[model samples]
Target: MRVRKLTFAALAVAAGLSLTACNGDDGTAQSDGSSSSSSSTSGGGSGSGGSEQGGGKDDSAGKSSAGSGSDAQAKAAKCRTDDLDITAKDSTIDGDDEGTVAVEFKNGGGRDCLLSGYAGVDLKTSEGDLSAERSGQESSPMVLKDGESVFFGVTYPLNESGGSGVKVSSLVITPPNETKSFSVEWPGAATLPVTDGSGSSVKVGPMGSAGQGGAS
Candidate 1:
């Protein structure tokens, strides 16, 4: 009877130890699960920070694009006739009877502006006004700051022989994209005759930075 009681006590002790071991294993599993959950939460926070960084980059790019649009909107205005100091002179080729009336435009304003296209020219004669034709050169926009200058030409044949021509006395000049007109006397008005019987021979060229035929 004493041996049987001792055997039964030993079995009970072993069962208790086994149950404790199982509880310990379950606790270890719970700890590992908690660690995994914490790691997952930490990874989620890191991903949120990355999203915020990307958002910041997007905002910066948006501001840069807006600034570029503003810069594009700040282009210069068209040059007005009141902003120019204009002069005209005769440009006779050495041997050819073909001649040019070089019209120089100086920007005398305080701000920068744009100059483009042909100068509206009308040759005033005794019979009637002869309007000059365009020379078919491409007119490009050019910026003219204060004190800058550009030139255009009024080309016509001298018609030294008594032929189909008109004797020009004065010129009515109009700058491009403007309504105001200014007058300058035709250089050598008494001697030179512009052959414009069809009224299409006298031609006006495009504006240039260098001189006549220097349009760009």
Candidate 2:
């Protein structure tokens, strides 16, 4: 009877040990599953943060591109005297005692420019130098592109009465807002006096875009 009691106790202890080993294996499997799940969640969070940071960099680059474009389209500059090619022509009407000379200012440079106001004129004569007066005409600013031209008028009374008058030999012209001057031969008839009597009645009109009118 004692031998049978010992065998039963050994069987009960063996069954208890097998149950404890199975419980330990189940706990280990559960812990491995939880660790894998936490690792996957951490990887997903890292990918999302990387995408947000990349998007912020792209936005900053776009803003920088827009600012550079604005700087490229800035305002234009004013015109200078070195950008022009000036010349003169006779524009007197037929059978009229009053004479007119059209002075054209052509833009010969590679860019656009602004031209306004009257051109200064001085007539070289045998008696003395005669300065032309402004005709008190209103003028607007003119924008001359490359190869474009603007005009102004010089009006004077002709010495058609065959009386003694001052003969103008040459013309000294100065562009508006400029200190330098240009001298050119008289464009009218060589023998004709440019003005009547003492030659103090010469006047210079305002700048114009058209060939006929003085200012427009």
Candidate 3:
């Protein structure tokens, strides 16, 4: 009876050891699975972040390219006459209608340009109606290179109705083969004094003013 009881106690001890070993193995497997799941989640998050960054860069590049294209189109659509710079020194002329008025033009562009014709002038009276003056066709073809200049002399007939100073309202410069028309205004012609003087003392009317002793 004593031996049988001893044998039963030994079997109980062995069963307890076996249970402990099985529990340890299960804990280690659970820990390893959890670690693997965490690593996978972190790796997936990193990959998504990288893709988002790359997509943002591509979008920015597309916008930049579109802007560049727009700018290029604007430059291409710009008229050649737009590049010309014209300045008149004393554009107003105060003289007998029988004489000529000279206008000087300077080209400020980097390339060459052509002047084809002038614009019509409209003369108005402060009190009544008057006829308009037409600028004659450009007699010779004029070309102005970069930093070059040319002078144009326009002559008109002096008549009795032209008295009280004529107003030169507008000057138009037309370029060859160009559809755009460039215009310069003479608002100062409104104040030109009428007198009979020659040489430098001769007072030229403002661009908006008529010749000496012409109708406003």
Candidate 4:
């Protein structure tokens, strides 16, 4: 009977040890799962933060590109005659320089401007009153952007008559309806053409686009 009691006590002790072992293993598994879950959550948060930061940088770069485009457009904005450079050359070398002249208009300012329609042309003589003639084709204003130029043609005759078919020295030019005149250096040894059997000789054509034949 005593032996039986001893055996029973030993068995009870063994059952308690088995239960403790099982509980300890369960706790260890739970702890490991919790640690793994925490680590995964932290990594996900870091990835999300990195993605947001990268998005912000891309947005900043886009805005910078847009700003540069706007600045370029602003610099290409309107023009005036006072901010222009004017030049002239003889047309039709096959004939007397008295026939036609090619006039070039260039933008000499920091901004762009519009130039269209006919320009007022006149001849200044060393021996007589200035000859003024209003001439040009009626048209719309062409957009003359900064650093751009347009061309036109003018016709005049050479008169070496002993009377008043005056000799030209300088040219007086004006923009349409602006009344502002630009004096151009005349390098021709020709005389102004006689228009009405008199001493006025000047006719201007409308300005043409760049790369045009100067008369269009």
* Best by the TM-score measure: 1
Clashing pairs in 4: 78-112, 78-113, 79-112, 79-113
- Candidate 4 is scored at a TM of 0.52
**Clashing pairs counted in every model:** 0, 0, 21, 4
* CA lDDT scores, all candidates in order: 0.80, 0.77, 0.51, 0.70
| lDDT at residue 14 of model 3 (Cα atoms) | 100
Candidate 1: lDDT of 98?
A: 73
**TM-scores for the candidates:** 0.70, 0.60, 0.38, 0.52
Report the C-alpha displacement of residue 210, candidate 2, in angstroms: 5.7
* Candidate 2 RMSD to the real structure: 5.4
The segments of candidate 1 whose C-alpha lies over 4 angstroms from its true place after superposition are 1-44, 65-73, 159-167, 191-196, 209-216
- Cα RMSD for predicted model 3: 13.2
Better of 1 and 2 by lDDT: 1
1-216 per-residue lDDT for model 4 (tens digits): 999999999999999999999999999999999999999978878788999999999999999898788565743333456888888776644556456667788888877776656777777775654654546456676778778778877766665555665567777778755678888877554665444656445666677722346322
Q: After TM-score superposition, what is the CA distance of residue 35 in candidate 4 from its true location, in Å? A: 51
**Regions of candidate 4 where Cα sits further than 4 Å from its true position:** 1-78, 96-98, 130-136, 160-165, 193-201, 209-216
Residue 209, model 3: lDDT of 30
